[model samples]
Target: MEQPAASGPPNVAVRAAEKRGYAVSKEQPERPGRPTLDAGRSGGVTVVGDPPRRPHARQRISTTLDLIRANPTGRIALKIFIAIAGALVVTIGIALIPLPGPGWLLVIAGLGIWAVEFHWARRLLGFTRRHVHGWTQWVTRQSLPVRLVLGAVGLVFVATVVWLSLKYSLGIDVVAEVMHYLATH
Candidate 1:
């Protein structure tokens, strides 16, 4: 029998092909412990690796924002737009606070919108996020009975507020109306 023919490693052939500007795959193969610079979708250079140093969501957002704010005139315009939009959202959120709706959620969303342009808003958002997390943790630590009691108290408080708001603001007495309707029916 003839001796077996020697064959070069598959990777060596692939690497040679790569040097000749011929990529077998659309996605370039990533090697461990080495970083590679690749062209990004937006025509920017992106560094990728085994442990890829991809842009954070915030970084990407800021980058897009920065592009929009390259000139002083554009920057001022963006700032104004953000401020107006954020104010409107926050105002609506504040208005909805006393009503049964996503008041806090809208408020946080407004803060996020403001955070895109304002450092103060970013700091306040972080503070609010921390406090909310703390409150959630504290509530979770309470006993089931305590939690239920707290919930009931909250419900009572909300009902009382809603009733008072309706009675004073709109001259509508819901409880009396309900009683009258029930009695008649």
Candidate 2:
């Protein structure tokens, strides 16, 4: 291609950008490293994604896990320890599930712990996360009244579980007590 006299690259750049379907502008080009609207569409916008993530603590385990994995016996020991820890947390969560607390949260936490070392657990955890995220998105998309009704339904479910747990585990029937009080009043 023949160079356009000595008119410089600015005009050529604008023509090139326009040809590429960019939102070209005549504004002065910003310095390197920082793009501007004149540069193109979505220029100058620093859209950072979610921070780097891991199911486990990276800093704490990075060096230690490598060191331990290097030894044959240590690998077995590590697996054993992880299994025991994950099982303990899950057991606690199962025991607490009937009560009013973070039982499900603990269960998921235990799964995350297992996921740190187990491929099966990682896949299961991912499945659980995707479903939960979908549920959240669905709920958010609903109307206000529908969302409120869903919240009320959740409250009722929790209340029933709490009542059942108290009655069965501690021999205390809170619902019956409240009913008796209401009758006397």
Clashes of 2: 0
36 in model 2: Cα distance from truth in Å?
30
Candidate 1, residue 156: Cα displacement in angstroms equals 1.2
What residue pairs are clashing in model 2? none
> Can you list the residue pairs that collide in candidate 1?
none
- lDDT tens digits by residue: candidate 2, 1-185: 22213211245554655575554334432333332233242434442244423323553365456445545676789888988999899899988887879899999999988987799999999999999999999999999999999999999998898899899989999988999999999
Q: Write the per-residue lDDT of candidate 1 for residues 46-108, one digit (tens) a residue.
A: 444456345457655654565446455767999999999999999999887777889879999
Model 1 C-alpha lDDT versus the unseen true structure: 0.73
| Candidate 2 accuracy as lDDT | 0.71
- On lDDT, the leading prediction is 1
Off by over 4 Å in 1: 1-59, 182-185
